[model samples]
Target: MTKSNFQILLADDDEDDCMFFKDALDELSLSATLKTVRNGVELMDFLENNLSNLPQVLFLDLNMPRKSGTECLLEIKESEKLRRLPVIIYSTSSNLEVMDMLYCKGAQYYIRKPADFADLKFVINRTISLLKEKNVQHPTREEFVIQT
Candidate 1:
C-alpha cells in the first residue's frame, strides 16, 4: 500500500479534548490524518482489527472509562503485531511514578495535556517533527516526558 500522509490515532474519552486535538491538527497544515477512539476498548479494537492500516503513532489518555491507557499500553507492548507501534501517553495527570512506569513499559512519550490551544498545537507539532525525524523511537529517560 502507498501511504502519503502520516496517520495518528488518539484514544481520549473527553469530547472537548478530542475536538481540540482534531482542530489542532487541522490548524497545523501538515499532511496527516487523525482518528479518534473514545475509550481503551475501541482503541484496542481498532488496532487489532486494522492490522493493515495501523497508525504510525497513538496518543493515549491515561484516564478513561473501561480499560485505562496504562492497560492499553501494556497490551500493545505485549502483542507482537502492535509492540512496535509508538504509543504516547497524553494525559492530564503528571504523576511521576505512573510516568516512570509507562516509560519503562515502552511508551514512546508522555505528554501532559496542555490547557491552552497554542500549547496543544506546539506539542502536536513537536510530536510530528519527532515522528518525521524518526529519532525518538527510543528516546532517553530525560526526554521521555514532554514538558510544555
Candidate 2:
C-alpha cells in the first residue's frame, strides 16, 4: 500500500488517550484506519473477523479494563492468520518486568506513551515513517512487523 493508503489499529482502554491518538494521526495525514478496541478480548474478536484484511500495524496499551496487552500480544503471536502484522505496546509506565515479558512474548516494539501532545505527534510521525521506509527483504512471504 502507498503512504496515503495505510491502516493502523490502536488498542487502548482509556477514551481520552485514544482520542488524543486520533488527533495526532489526523494531524500527520497518515491515512490510517484507527480501530479502537476496549480491551484485549475485543481486540481478539476484531482480529478474528478482520484477519483477512488486518491493519498494517497495531499500537496497544498495557493496562486495560479487561484483558491486558500482554494477553493480546500472546494471542496474536500464536495466531496463524493474524501473526504477521506489527504490534507495538504503547504504555505509560516503563516497568522492566513488563517490558521484558512483552518482548519475550513476541511484541514487535515497546513505546512509552508520551505525556505531551507535541511529543505524541512526533512519536506517531516517526512510527509512520518507519513503516513507510521499511525494507521487505523477503517480499514473497508475509512477515510480521517486528517493532522491538
Candidate 3:
C-alpha cells in the first residue's frame, strides 16, 4: 500500500465511536481511506468478498451484536487467505488478561479507546506510523498494548 493511500477497515457497533474515529482521521489529514462495518458479520463478509483488495489494517472492536471481535480474530488468523491481515484490537477494555489473550490470538496491536479526542488522534497516528515502520509485523508483548 502507498503511504498516501493507506486503507483501513474498522469493525465497530457503536455509532458514536465510529463517527469519532472517522472525525479523527479527517482531522489528521492523512491520505487514508476508511471503511467501516458495524458488526462482526459484516466485517467478515466484507473481508471475504474483498479478498483481492484487503485493507492495510483492520481496527476491530471486541463487542458486537452477532459475532464478537475475538471470534472474528480467530477466524481471520485461521483462514489462509486472511491470516496475514494486520488486526488491531480497538476497544475500551484495557484488561491485561484480555489484552494478553488477544495478543496470543495473533492481534498485531491493542488500543484501548481513548476518552479524549487528542489522545485518540495521538494513538491513531502512532498506530499508522508503527504499521508503516514495522511492515505489519507482530510486535513483542510489551509493545502490543499501545498507550497514549
Candidate 4:
C-alpha cells in the first residue's frame, strides 16, 4: 500500500517496544502512519478526539500503567462504530488465560510477543500480512465516516 493509504493505531506503554516496532515496520516497507498511545485512557481519549478520524487497525499491549489493554478492547468492542475495526492483542505475556480473555474480548488475533528482536520483527511482519489478508477477505468499515 502507498504511504497515503497507510494508518495504524498502536497502544503500547513501553517506548523501547514502539521503537523496535517502528524499525520492523520500516524493514517491511509498510507505508503506514502509526499513532501511538501510552495507555488505555489515552487511547480512549484519542477515539473521542475526532469523530472523523478512525484507524483501520489497532495493536494493543495487554499491560499498561493506568488502564489495561483488555479494558480498552472491551470498550472498543462495545462501541457500535468501533466493533468492526480489526484489533490485535499483541502482548509480551504468553498466558493462556489472557489470550483467551482477549479473544473473548473481541480481539481478531491474540499474538504472544517474541523474545528476541529478530523474532519480534518476524511476528510483526506476519501479523501485518495476516491482517492484510483478513481485510481483503472481509471488508467491513463502519458508516461513521472516519478519516484515514
- For each candidate in turn, give its C-alpha RMSD to the true structure in angstroms: 1.7, 4.7, 0.7, 6.7
lDDT of each: 0.89, 0.77, 0.95, 0.73
lDDT of 2 by residue, 67-89 (tens): 88888888898988877777778
In terms of lDDT, the poorest run of 10 residues in model 4 is 139-148
Candidate 2 vs. true structure, TM-score = 0.86
* Clash count per candidate: 0, 2, 0, 1
lDDT of 3 at 68: 99
Candidate number of the best TM-score: 3
Please give, for residues 1-148, the per-residue lDDT of candidate 1 as tens digits. 1235788999999999999999998899777888999998998999999999898899999998899999999999999999989999999998899988999999998899999999999999887777667754788879887776
Clashing pairs in 4: 52-147
For candidate 3, which ten residues in a row score worst on lDDT? 1-10
CA RMSD (A), model 1? 1.7
C-alpha RMSD of candidate 2: 4.7
Instruction: List candidate 4 segments past 4 Å from native.
Output: 1-4, 136-148
Clashes of 1: 0
Model 3, 66-140: lDDT tens digits are 999999999999999999999999999978999999999999999999989999999999999999899888999
Ranking by TM-score: 3, 1, 2, 4
TM-score for each model: 0.95, 0.86, 0.98, 0.83
